[model samples]
Target: MDTGPETGTGTSEQTTSQSARPGYKQLLRTADAWTFLLPGFAARQPFAMLTIGIVLLVQHTTGSYGSAGVVSAATGVSMALFAPQSGKLADRFGQGAVLLPGVLVHTAAIAALISLALAHAPLWALLAAAVPAGASVPQVGPMVRSRWAVKLNGSPLMSTAAAFESVTDEFTFVVGPVLATALCTSVHPAAGLVAEAALTLVGGLLFAAQRRTAPVPSRLAGGGTRHASALTVPGVRVLAIVFLGIGSVFGGMQVSLTAFTQAIGEPGINGLLYGTFAAGNMCAGVVCGAIAWKVTPQRRLLVAYPLLTLACSTLWAVHAVPLLGALGLLVGLCIAPSLITGYTLVESLVPAAARTEAFTWLTGAVALGQAAAATVSGQLADRFGASAGFLVPLGGTALALATLLTLRRRLSTTRQDG
Candidate 1:
């Protein structure tokens, strides 16, 4: 049976083999690609902003960093739990049907959260509002990447697209904190959350309207036989576990950096230090995208993972602010490439039907890792000082390296089959 292009994996593969290396200009010009990309970029801005916003709001209203930490943790946990379910829904239904409603609900909940905080609502009420707010956040990152996979599917341009997305992700993380902090401090404590809600709604709606590039629902693609969950796919669980370690590095770095800044009586410079870290990733991602590499994604990860481990290990020994900032930049250089490689591997491992869910699961693993790292590292910093907290990320990177080494054979097999 010859399915139409929308449902035809074979067609995508054929196109990929025949296509030449597409430069950035050529890729950008391909079929409303900017229209498709802009919304995703806008939608993702909130991912960086929300946690900071929540922390600031809670702290401002309640005068308790401990309470703020709990609220932020609750939000992360809710989003991590729900991200895969949201992706599964998008896979089963059309993106528009699933995304638009999810975005709306999530935005509304964020607005309500801001209002509750502003009104000085009961602590429980404020905490309760965060659940729905986080739960409803559309899995925009996964959905957008899925669109790129469908559009660019077997082509080399897919690597470029992934790199571009990684760069944007780095940009969002860098900017989100600065923007959130600026708004919360200079304008009003609620402004950051308000901006997040507005941007999410607008960006999500714009993204959903680009129906032409959205992946076909699994049911429609497969004539209603349920697709296997991405989790069921070989090697996916292992990849998720490795990504968890990677995420722990990120989470631990964040908490440790903040603690370090506070310890040095320069808490305000935390955003600057984070931007330095993200800047390194952004530059590296661009370079990675521009160059054509002969190495497979698995091999690329093997090299990058150890570099990350080395950079993070160095972080544990650095006490001077200037030296630590340079090390942070070095760590950033390793991060984007590793992430891009991971996304590329996920694409190869999972079937088209389960792509979004698989990607979301990877993201969820990172979130869980981050949450765990933050909790543990926070305590370590409190008890033994920020320098001791650096061990959390150092340990995380070491584990990631070990996992990559242990699973290289399985990963190679999956890539070969893919």
Candidate 2:
């Protein structure tokens, strides 16, 4: 039996062979490709910025990185818990119906959180504001992937679409953090959150307006009956765990970089260092998409994940800024392959009806891991130092690697289900 994604096409081997070759130019020219892509990119930029912005503002207000991490973690935790539900609603209803109200709520919630932070309200008040802000985050990334799946369901270009989306995500990370950090440090502590809110409102509206390209609601696609959650699939669970490890790397890096820069008495360089790491991810994504590969996504994922762990292991030992930046770039380079592969595997693992929900579960797991890492790393950095904070990524990825090794067989998708 063929082990590749069942793209609904009978010629799995032929399609898989074609997928290994470059065809991004063809993907770009697909009908209505840019109609949603531009707005979707704009809408998701806040996803990368929100947590870091919260961290900066709260730290500035409270004079405690630990406090900052706790607040941001609350936001991330809420997002993790609620994002999948949002996706489920989108699958049943429509993306526009779900996104419009979500963006509105998110903007108001973020504004409230910023105001309370500036007012020096109690942490409980801030946490209350954070939960809604996070819970209301628009599920743009997963929604966009769902659209791509609709557009190129069984086409060989679907693999390229995954790579392209990964590249787009990395690019947003590259821009979002640098923009947030610059705004926060150079302008005002709350400037980043303000910008994030504005972008979410405007971009979310624009993306929601593009109803022409939106996937048909599963309720409409199928019968009116309810669909099961994506987590029912064992592969989704495994992938979600893998993404959590990746999220820990992101969270640990954010806090540890802040501490490292502040320790050197040049806190402004934190953005540049993080940007360098993000640039590595974007570069790798570009290359990953362009190459033709005969190896399956599962095998590619297994290879890439161990490399990510090995790269992260050295993060705790680096003290010099340049050395740390170099190490960060290396770590970033190892990340895209695993991310791209995991996403590619999802096409074969989950049914089309629950695709959006499956994507959100993986995305939410990242947010959840990032939240946990940010909290622990922040506390460690405050009491111990930045070096201690850096250990979180290594520890998270190592544990995940062990899990992957133990449950490697579960990662395979022998059949696709809806």
Best by lDDT: 2
Q: Which ten residues in a row have the lowest lDDT in candidate 2?
A: 1-10
Superposed by TM-score, candidate 2 places the C-alpha of residue 186 at a distance from the truth, in angstroms, of 1.1
Looking at candidate 1, what is the lDDT of residue 102? 86
Regions of candidate 1 where Cα sits further than 4 Å from its true position: 1-18, 61-66, 115-126, 413-418
Q: What's model 1's overall lDDT?
A: 0.78
lDDT of the candidates, in the order given: 0.78, 0.89
lDDT of 2: 0.89
Residue pairs that clash (backbone atoms under 3 angstroms), model 2: none
lDDT of 1 by residue, 1-418 (tens): 2222355454754374337574566567555568778888998899888877776677679865446656766676788788888888888887888888888898888988888988999878887888888788777888888877776766777777788888888899889877887788778989989999989999988889988778888777778877778888657777787778877776777677767887898867877787788888888988888877789988898888888888888777789999989998998898888888888887778778788898898888777777667667766776788887689888887887787788777674353222
Q: What C-alpha RMSD separates each model from the true structure?
A: 2.9, 3.6
lDDT of 1 at 271: 72
lDDT of 2 by residue, 1-418 (tens): 2111233433543454346445788778666779999999999999989988999999999989899999999999999999999999998898999999999999999999999999999999999999999999999999999888776766667778889999999898899999999999999999999999999999999999998778788777777866678898888889999999999999999998998898989989888999899889988988888776789888999999999999999899889889999999999999999899888888888887888899999899999999999999999999998889999999999988888888889887764563
